[model samples]
Target chain A: MVNAVTTGADAKVSVRNLEIAYGDATALSGVDLDIRENEIFGVIGPANAGKTSFLKALNRMDMFNPEMKVGGDIHFSGRNTRGLRNVYALRRRIGVVFPLPVGLPMNVYDNVALAPRLGGQRNRAELDVIVERCLRRAALWDEVKDRLDTLGSLLSGGQQQRLTIARALSQQPEVLMLDEFSIAVDPVTTMRIEDVLKQLREEMTIILVTNLVQQARRLADRTAFFLDGRCVEIGVTEDLFTGEVRDQRTRDYVEGRFG
Target chain B: MSRSSVTDFDRRNRDWYIDRLVQAVVFIGGISAIVFIIGIFVFITREGFSFIATEFDVSGFFLSQNWRPTSESNPTYGILALVAGTASVTGLAMLVAIPFSLGAAIFIAEFATGRVREVLKILVELLAAIPSVVWGFIGLSIMNPLIIEWFNVPVGLNVLNAGIILGLMAAPIMTSIAEDALKAVPDRYREAAEAMGATRWQVIAKVVLPAAKNGLLGAVLLGVGRGFGETMAVLMATGHSVNIPTSIFDSVRALTATIAAELGETAVGSPHYQALFTIGIFLFAITFVINLTADLIVRGIRNK
Candidate 1:
């Protein structure tokens, strides 16, 4: 356990003593954190620092891998995730965006409409409204409105990344988790998506896992520094940079001395 | 010194000679397939030519059911009944094979894992390796008695018995190919769909199946080809009666069986022998078309 500043009552997600392992190799362990509701929580770490593994554990993705073992408790809202009978219902409330854009092998309209359809929304008019609003919120509607029937994979890399954001938003989730969302986007597109994330913070709690240290500074209300499979420090985003940090490693990593 | 080094580098070694020899051997092996196919086609054409050019009546050969090649007087070679028998049996075989193989493929590819998956894969391969004659034997000894007892049909060996045997025979290979097709779909697509909260069934139905449709179609066509080309099982199980089948219980004859059964007894230059060769040509063309179509459909996935 690391950060004890936030209480469990206000936290959107409370994870305690979480551990993840694949076969014999442990990827992450002893992680404790509280993500407040409607706050942009940034997680910064280098490659293989278990940032991606942490997000995967949040949604119980270990079920797909027979060799992956997960232990300890993760509470979403107030209910314990491990005790839930239907994992699909739990996943529906938490949206995820991968590092590289995954524009499902479908048309743009259908891609954005997939999650809602999975949830049993069959009305065409309702689907149309949801698709438009999600795409618009991701800043992609105007660019793709004329050619909604084209394959989503045919779009430019930057556009596809935005399209992925639109797809994640389509679920209308309570928590939106993005893993290195801007790794494949241009600087300008990255800034544009950053603005969209800032706006999204008002509606949902956003967990942004980023490699860019400055990105955490720009948007996160509070940030947690992960190092070598452990959460090193958690504090106000500005305080971590300007004020004193408890761990020297957090300052060294944030200052770009070493990963 | 620089010139000497360049000359040494350019000199061919023993490895280069071995490489050339292996390439030449593989080239001959590759080209022999076309050579043998053409050779077989020419020989069959020559053997069947006299009957085709002289006595072959287009309408009677295709539309009439009479195949009395052994008659002392009228010796007609109409094969309508044979065509119908082959068509019916193959059609029924496909009906049984498609679902069984596709379901097995879905289980092996999507559901089964670790030791279970490995065991299932080996079992399927073993099933594919079983001799057609053994399947024919089972149809003769086992399925024949079972079908007669269950359905109370007069004939034990008939279209249904042969069709079921052929379908079971075709399923393992079809399952193997369909599994390969399903496996070809990238894991990322599955991961993405799973992350979106789609249930296991929903992920397969909505994403995986649509992506693998072409390959699945190819697998079915290959099974149809196998059913068409199969002879020993059809001969032993179908009772080899020369008739146009009306129902599943009706015993029937197939084109390949006719060639295999009669070619041994007919005199070399007799019209009876030539007529059998004509049936051979027809069987060859149909199987060729089916196999080529399967190949093309499977290739379509790679291009995309």
Candidate 2:
């Protein structure tokens, strides 16, 4: 779908002719995207449409899966990320949250403290501030502040999701990716987290992958509609929702037709 | 009978009977193991009761450093020296085994890829396959001379030599079990930690090892138990001096070694022979406690 679009020089993340596969089975092919800085770039796609694969590619999370293979040029903040020796540094800057509530098997405080600790922050006072700030930003401080000693895994699903977000936030990321962050979260918690994401975009670039098309309309500045391992449409969220989607499939998806 | 004539109800009833039969079979199979273990304990303790009643000095048997079973006139059977010997050998074995075993486990679980992991695993199994008697022979012939050359001790087959060989015997078991524990760690934890910029070592040290604590404990304790109960290797490797070891190089008599050396020569129904049963109880108790603790840890892991 991005075949007609030109690569934006000012984009924070630029993908060109990207193709991804696991072993011999292709997941995505001939994909291109330019994600501008400090915008909530929403990726909306059906299940198995390579939305998570795209996100995984950005931070080289594919390293964990030996079967996964990528053939593309992905430039993050103007630096090429292909075969980069320091993938951990790249991943640290591009924080990611999974589809499920995956709080670390540790206390609430340690969950948030982990990223900062990984970054070599040893001072108890500094860690406290970092943890508190991240938790507050994730809108989990009020619920978890009194029970920082409790295991994060023991929390309610919504709370754990928030704690995961808080942990991601503690990484001091330049780009924050939330992959179906509201999958198990309550509607109220979802709205709260959406609001938090809006605020977060002011400080860092946000990539929001969601099945909820309306969630994209609510929070995304720019949205890409992925279909069957291809980008079917890419435009402003408002333009995509304005009953004039460039692609018919995007209109169909946005209007609750066949995904 | 026609296939259609056999109703679904009849087939279901047949399945129910078969399932119950299988269930009963499995129940008996499981209970037999427990019954056998209990039977061994009961039979041994029955033989030991006479010794415990008359000849066994409960306190001095453990505290006193005398272990003279062969003395014709005044045969003292204080097992404190034997217990001390067992402790030193087992303790020294642990010190040698833990780092190497954990290193092997980490390498297999975290670092080695598919084929390499399998190859390393086979190597560990090969190590475990070597008999205790062969290890004892190797220590006696090859290692003892090297020790005498280096340490300049009169006899090279001292506590150090026995402990070294025992450590070698136990390392494979420890590594394999620990690796299994490490492998059992959920991938999500590593993914989360790595996403937070934690390196591979950091993920292992902070997350994988901590998450697999129970398994690691079980592995180490079971390994220690192996060292504790090993009879042939310690009997051949240690010089079997009946005294408290002042140093790692000092010759000592482990509980297993004492039993192996004296059991055949002692007359049946004699106090010395019955006292050997008491020593059996000591060995049984230590092995039982270690195994039980390991089982508890495994159960706790399963419960979690």
Candidate 3:
């Protein structure tokens, strides 16, 4: 049941009948979603609901694990992602931030510059500009500007979270997948990052996966509610909150009832 | 209801005795290792000192370049040449071993999975199980001639030859320890790198290797310790010449080789025998320091 108004628009990422399994256990099964271009697409679900797995699948992170088995099609910009020869190029265009912030063993400056360096932007001045722009976009420039040489791992949790955001942003991705990016961040920092995500929406598609229903409500143009590894409902964010959810479970979850 | 049968008093009594028994057993286990080490140290030192009493030429013992204990007119106790030989062979060995070992480590940690990784690990363990003398035999029969033919040297029994053998001897150990270090790096770091468009090689070179830096260093140091103390292999491969080697190709004698080669023939109470004991002290001290420092660095990294 596709919404007539939004179904055929320029979709940035399209997933069809996506099923993911790790050994004997299945993480996600029969998931379908289309993330439109330059829109903040929110994913709200409870723990173990395969929200992170979905984000991981979007970036083809399953390639790292031999045990992980993925079935069905995931397309990026009308091209089948599974068929892409250069996975790194596809990954560069689809950046992901995990639930927990992962700081590189190197310093802050190097952390942001690393992706660009991998992509062959070796000029120091150019890296410096990219790093500054990304950090500024993530609202982390002022605190870390003076300490760019400091070890990335030594930053405070909130700052580290922002740095992860900045690092992902530095890649200049087509679709930015943030999987519970604010879990480690404080409420104030979460709001700041939310502002960053809203600002980033004009340039690229945003896939914000969160446990907080209100966060999805606040930022998403269209929202998908995942339960037991299946999308229960997907509608305009306002409809999910304004007593117009297609599924009763969506209304219950959005109204702060059972997940 | 069952609480009445197994009361707190009875449980506490059983727990206390079992805990004491465990404590005593663990203490004995831990203390025995230290005691054994200390006892060995004392024994070696006593033997080394017994030699010193007759001839206390400490400077000649350490700094002298000539080692002619068998000379009829005069005997020199200079160990500089032996030390030089040991240094050259070990240095060359390390140069060969580190690259191959690190490569194996990266392969096992980042690339191989499932049955392949398991098989490789067992193969590494089997490589280590092969006796040092057997490795020496392999070097003597196979590698020595190859080296001579490859480099067109006068003799294959030189520092380079010994070094190659020692490098093989140390590679398995180096690979295992380095693999441990590389494996200790969390998956998240690798994922973060990959998600940022980093290739497999780039992720390893930049993130995983750096994260495993101290552990990798510890692995190298352990390899050095293994190379330094290796006796039978070096004894067989190195030509056992007491002269300092001018190059890796020149025939040379490691300290262990000298001790191993000369100790059995000399009269037990003689200065030569005691001097061999002195060389053992140097080997022990150097091994202890390298291993201890490596342990410290690894622990420091883990703590951080």
Among these predictions, the greatest TM-score belongs to 1
Task: Give the Cα-based TM-score of candidate 2 against the true structure.
Answer: 0.95
Clash pairs, candidate 3, are none
What is candidate 3's lDDT per residue for B171-264, written digit by digit as tens?
9988999999998898889989999889999999989998999999999999899988999999889988877888878888999889888998
- Candidate 1 lDDT (Cα, whole model)? 0.91
Residue-wise C-alpha lDDT for candidate 3, range A50-76, written one tens digit per residue: 888888888888888878888988878
Over A29-99, each residue of candidate 2 has an lDDT whose tens digit, in order, gives: 88888999999999998998999999988898888789999988888887888869988899889888998
In model 1, the runs with Cα more than 4 Å from the true position are A1-7, B1-4
The 10 consecutive residues of candidate 3 chain A with the worst lDDT sum are A1-10
Looking at model 1, give its docking quality level: medium
Whole-model Cα lDDT per candidate? 0.91, 0.89, 0.89
Better of 1 and 3 by TM-score: 1
Task: Report the C-alpha displacement of residue B144, candidate 2, in angstroms.
Answer: 1.1
Against the true two-chain complex, what DockQ does each candidate achieve? 0.75, 0.69, 0.84
Cα RMSD for candidates in order: 2.4, 2.8, 2.9
Clashes of each: 0, 0, 0
Instruction: Give residue A184's lDDT in candidate 1 (0 to 100).
Output: 91
> What is the lDDT, from 0 to 100, of the residue B178 in candidate 1?
96
Docking class of 3: high
- Identify the candidate with maximal lDDT: 1
Structure candidate 1, residue pairs in collision: none
